[model samples]
Target: MYGIVLSRRDFREADQVITILTAEEGKREYIARGVKKIVSKNTSHLEPATLISFGIAEGKKEFSYLTNVQPVESFFHLRQSLPTLHIIGYSLDALFTMLKEGEADSDIYQLYISYLRFLNTQEQVRLLLLDAFLIKLFSHLGYHPSLDACVVCEKTYKEIGLEFLSATEQKPGFYFAGGGIICASCKAEKQRIGEVAYPCGIKEINTLRFLLASSWQDVVSFPLDEEEYRLVHKLIYEFMLYHSERKWDDWGKISLIMT
Candidate 1:
């Protein structure tokens, strides 16, 4: 089956356990026996994000072993660039943290493949692609943030009079616990209930809405200034962490790379 190596962990002696995201099987853990040996050809092919085809050997235990790996796309160029490498590492780390073992989702598998392909060719837009991928990944995982209207009141931005908010005006509040942007009215109501919200400027709010609504083709061309990019990155990263309930050590590193 065709798969991407998501992560690898050393096992007893020269063996290791490799977690692979397969096109057909979603995520599967396989034992690669003696792969830690000096002459093992499988070691390099098993690196994270390496795409390959391999056969599964059913073992007496619950897990399976990998055999006959044929490399498809190694994405070697990613290693040559520090920023791209960091993004790849962050992406893989997020995937590894969120994806459950043996859970099959073909859409996510395809999305991952597309992400790698894009990263392989487009170095300039890696950050944008990563952000877009994160948004889409959350959508695929059924945790898509409600960006169109107020999460609490369900009112449109125009109805809430946020569309005309000036740069100097107090920005709309983003209530992470409430799942999305809160209108002025709902923000007041939330305040009465002792729930605090994060302030998000009009530009940042609109940028996020566009991202959630746009395709990768369109998103690639979307213009974002350094400040706008920073806002979007912080919002998305925090949102993912809050919803996923997982703290990633690489978050600061990836943020630094984006800057």
Candidate 2:
């Protein structure tokens, strides 16, 4: 089976427990004995986030042994950029959390590899690769937002605004939690009933629309101004946090490293 190394950790004296996202199995764990030795044969071939082809010998229902492993792509460029590495870490964590053991998702594997290659570019464009990656990943996971039309009235979002509940006050700002835009009528209705307090503008609305509609390559090519980039980043991060219910702690260390 072919897989990408998702994570690895020490298990015993000379063994390491490794997790991989494979084409045959969605995600699986294996114990590679004697992997810590300096002269270990598989030591260089097994690296977190590298593409690898391996043969697995199933020992029990829960785990397996990595009998043979061949490196396919190391993504060496990602090592030089701390932010890109952090983004990859966050993405892999999200995938690992949602993926089920023994399930096959070949399409997801292909999408992942393609996205990674795109991310290795030298362009350094403003649209956060992390944000694009999350949106694309969610699309694959079937949680993609309905941006073609309004979530309330089902009308095309010709031009819409965004509302965000501030993280500090827990106040409902401007957002349509159901799917797409919350029309003026619905916004007024909610405010009349004391459901929300304030309004957030539509300056970034078109950018959101473009993001939802654009291809991955187009998104990477488009340049995002500072404000829009920051807004989109926050939105993607918030959406993921709300849906996954998982706190991402490593992000802070990653940010520090990048700075």
Candidate that scores best on TM-score: 1
| Residue pair clashes in candidate 2 | 163-174
Local accuracy by lDDT, each model: 0.79, 0.66
Best by lDDT: 1
lDDT of each residue in 1-259, candidate 2, tens digit only: 7788888889879999988887777778888878999989898778777888888787766667898788888888876776677677777887788777767888778878876776676435233555766766776676676655446665445433322322322222234356444555566667788653223334445555576667667876777776666665665555566557567552323443311
Residue-level lDDT of model 1, residues 1-259, one tens digit each, is 8999999999989899999998677887899989989999998999899999999889886868889988999997767777778778878987888888888999999988887887777565447667777877887888877777889878887655544354335457788887778876677678788887777766777778788778766788888877788888788777787778767563434554544
Q: What's the residue-level lDDT of 200 in candidate 2?
A: 32
Relative to the true structure, candidate 1 reaches a TM of: 0.89
Q: What C-alpha RMSD separates each model from the true structure?
A: 2.4, 5.1
Weakest 10 consecutive residues of candidate 2 by summed lDDT:
163-172
